[model samples]
Target: MKKGCLIGGIVLLAILSIALGYYFYQQSKTDPVVYEFESPVYQEIIKKTVATGSIKPRKEVQIKP
Candidate 1:
């Protein structure tokens, strides 16, 4: 019947629309344009340093009762 044909057409259109949307979504995540450029200048960079140690004394004190 004509109703069955209409339903079939609607289903086909919906499937095609979803497929095209997913295809375009996958294409937007690529970085082809941003990776082609290089930096123009370079500079000297300094990093932070850390020191760790323990101190010792010559005599020890005792408490009397």
Candidate 2:
């Protein structure tokens, strides 16, 4: 049936996507890009991706009295 085939195709694509994502994630874990910097020249890092305007999180410290 056409409906059965359509559902099967969607399921197949979903499984393929998950498998590909897992493979790429595993590869990145082992072979990630690393950037080392001298203490002074580190300000040039791109704070966020160009399209999205998100900023990095700041550390927080709490004082207990």
Candidate 3:
């Protein structure tokens, strides 16, 4: 029984190692990213914003004579 259990553990570990190795191998086979850059073009960008609101003070001050 002990020998059987030891063999089973080793088999499980081997399967896990093989699966991880295959996964990493597949990952490494992926194509590298190739970027295409274009020359800079001059263009006008205009942004206009209008806000309508009244601003008020949070606290009021009192004057004593």
Candidate 4:
């Protein structure tokens, strides 16, 4: 019984060590993503109209100085 317990303890220790090593290896290969953001904002958005044109005088008025 003592021999069996010793063997089991050694096996359990080995398994734990291997699992821990694999866990750390995977962690080292990964980059942790940290996301920081602002809270929600409620407001009105105004829509603007874009026009392309040139203004011309309907009638040319001559001014004498």
Candidate 5:
């Protein structure tokens, strides 16, 4: 009985090891990464600004209850 158990345990371990090895081997067979790039284009940019009137801050404050 002991010998049978030992052989069975060894066979189970061997099967597990082979399964893991095959999984990693398949994982390593994936395709490599690919990258795509485009050239930069030049363009003229115009900026304009117009301002009128004055700005002022509020003068009221309330405390929380």
Candidate 6:
């Protein structure tokens, strides 16, 4: 049947695509070229910050009014 042929073709295409993808992935992992550089030393830093008071949530209020 034509439908059966179409289905078979589609399945074959999917299998071939997956196989190619896996082959390329394996190839890349096996013959990989890596280049790394030494990073600069980091210096410790101390930062100071101050925050101004702003409007707060209703739950945070004393509600004495």
Highest lDDT: give the candidate number.
Answer: 3
For residue 4, what is the lDDT in candidate 2? 100
**Stretches of candidate 5 above 4 Å error?**
32-65
What TM-score should be assigned to candidate 6?
Answer: 0.46
RMSD to native, candidate 6:
9.4
Span of ten consecutive residues with least summed lDDT in model 1: 30-39
Task: Please give the CA lDDT of all the candidate structures.
Answer: 0.90, 0.86, 0.96, 0.96, 0.94, 0.91
Please list the residue runs of candidate 4 whose C-alpha ends up more than 4 Å from where it truly belongs after superposition. Answer: 31-65
lDDT by residue for model 2 (1-65), tens: 99999999999999999999999998878666799976755456556555757876698788899
Q: lDDT-based ranking, best first?
A: 3, 4, 5, 6, 1, 2
Candidate 3's TM-score? 0.46
Q: Write the per-residue lDDT of candidate 5 for residues 3-22, one digit (tens) a residue.
A: 99999999999999999999
lDDT tens digits, residue span 1-65, model 1: 99999999999999999999999999878766655678788888899998799777799888799
> Highest TM-score, which number?
5
Better of 4 and 5 by lDDT: 4
Over 1-65, each residue of candidate 4 has an lDDT whose tens digit, in order, gives: 99999999999999999999999998889677899999999999999999899989999999999
What is the alpha-carbon lDDT for the whole of candidate 6? 0.91
Error of 1 at 60 (Å): 90
Measured over all alpha carbons after superposition, the RMSD of each candidate to the real structure, in angstroms, is 8.0, 19.9, 5.7, 13.6, 8.4, 9.4
lDDT of 4: 0.96
Deviation from native of the Cα of residue 30 in model 6, angstroms: 4.1
By the lDDT metric, which is better: model 3 or model 6? Answer: 3
Q: Which lDDT value does model 3 have at 24? A: 97
lDDT of 3 by residue, 1-65 (tens): 99999999999999999999999999889688999999999999999999899988999899899
